[model samples]
Target chain A: GQQVMQIPQYQHVQEGEDFTTYCNSSTTLSNIQWYKQRPGGHPVFLIQLVKSGEVKKQKRLTFQFGEAKKNSSLHITATQTTDVGTYFCAGRFYNFGNEKLTFGTGTRLTIIP
Target chain B: DVKVTQSSRYLVKRTGEKVFLECVQDMDHENMFWYRQDPGLGLRLIYFSYDVKMKEKGDIPEGYSVSREKKERFSLILESASTNQTSMYLCASSFPRTGNQNQPQHFGDGTRLSIL
Candidate 1:
């Protein structure tokens, strides 16, 4: 079974500071998706990356897929209080012709006001 | 705006009791999934149904079952609830745009179940 590891299990940053979370995998992945879950809320889709070395941006947030497709990272510039939540990276892989998505343990981010 | 609805937002049951968690999706999705979320374990899949009357076991499916008699409805059943089963249950639905492409999943608010 493939597993995804997320670094910085918990983090706290002063408001207006930068924040980043890394997702790593031992094996190559077909694609990777990022999700955000607010306190007492369900996980919501943020973005997905497929091609290697791909970089995508959503306003102040940037996402990048590693050149080898074995890792991904999410970076937020000037984090705000509303940016506080748990970020998760899910990787898709195939096993015996069956496709599965392995979700990372997640990185909890806290913004200090 | 896709809406995935779970029957209950919170539930509590005693050990050894049979519990059923219901989920419904307004969007006509081809896939429905059940996952349990723990503090450090992330989201562990329990079961998924791609079509009506079809189900597949996920990473952690022991002591659990699923029913998908209709396309819009998916149910997760606990044969015998235990204290270990106390966690947040999430239901998701996705539409397969193509055969191999995996689309974004729409999740319900989730059910926080506690076993006494």
Candidate 2:
């Protein structure tokens, strides 16, 4: 079975502070996707990382995939109140069927004004 | 933008009653999935369909079944509702990916189901 685990289950930061969440997978993954779920809302796709040791950025957020493709990280620079939500990392294994994705427990981010 | 709609935002049912959670996607995605979200469990896949009439079991499909009569519709069925089955159910749809690549999934708001 494949598992994706996230660190810092919950995080609280003041405006202008930085935050980061780590994700590790039990098995090697072909690719990994990041999603954000707002309070009382559904999960929304953020970004996807495919190549090993790849890094992508979306405005204030940066995503990195480990060289082994078994780990990933999301970093936010100068966090804002609007960044409050739970960030999840999902992985698709190399040989596993593509029908389903294994989602991480998620890191809940809260920002203080 | 992709939109996925769930039949209900909230539902209440009694034990031993059959329940169905309907999901529809405006985008003609080739893949659809059903998942349950709990406080610490995150999103656990229950079932998924790659094409109409084509289905597959996911990580937690013990108490669930799925239907995919059409490309845009996917349904999750609970044979007999139980208290332990109470959770937020989510439906998602995505375009099929090639090889080992993964596609982005669009999710509906989800159905909060309660079994008494």
Query: Which candidate achieves the best lDDT against the true structure?
Result: 2
lDDT for predicted candidate 2 compared with the true structure? 0.93
TM-scores of chain A in all candidate models: 0.95, 0.97
lDDT of 1 by residue, B1-116 (tens): 89999999999999999999999999999899999999988898889888899988888999999999999999999999999999999999998635545789899999999999
* DockQ metric, candidate 2: 0.82
Q: Candidate 2 — which pairs collide? A: none
**lDDT values for all models:** 0.92, 0.93
User: What docking grade does candidate 1 earn?
Assistant: medium
Clashing pairs in 1: none
Candidate 1 stretches with Cα past 4 Å from truth are A96-99, B97-100
* N/CA/C clash count, model 1: 0
Q: Model 1 over residues A22-111: C-alpha lDDT tens digits?
A: 999999888889999999899999998988899999999999999999999999999999999999998887552233578999999998
Taking the tens digit of each residue's C-alpha lDDT, what string does model 2 give over A9-82?
A: 99999999999999998789889999999999999999999999999999999999999999999999999889
DockQ of each: 0.59, 0.82
* A50: Cα error in model 1, Å: 0.4
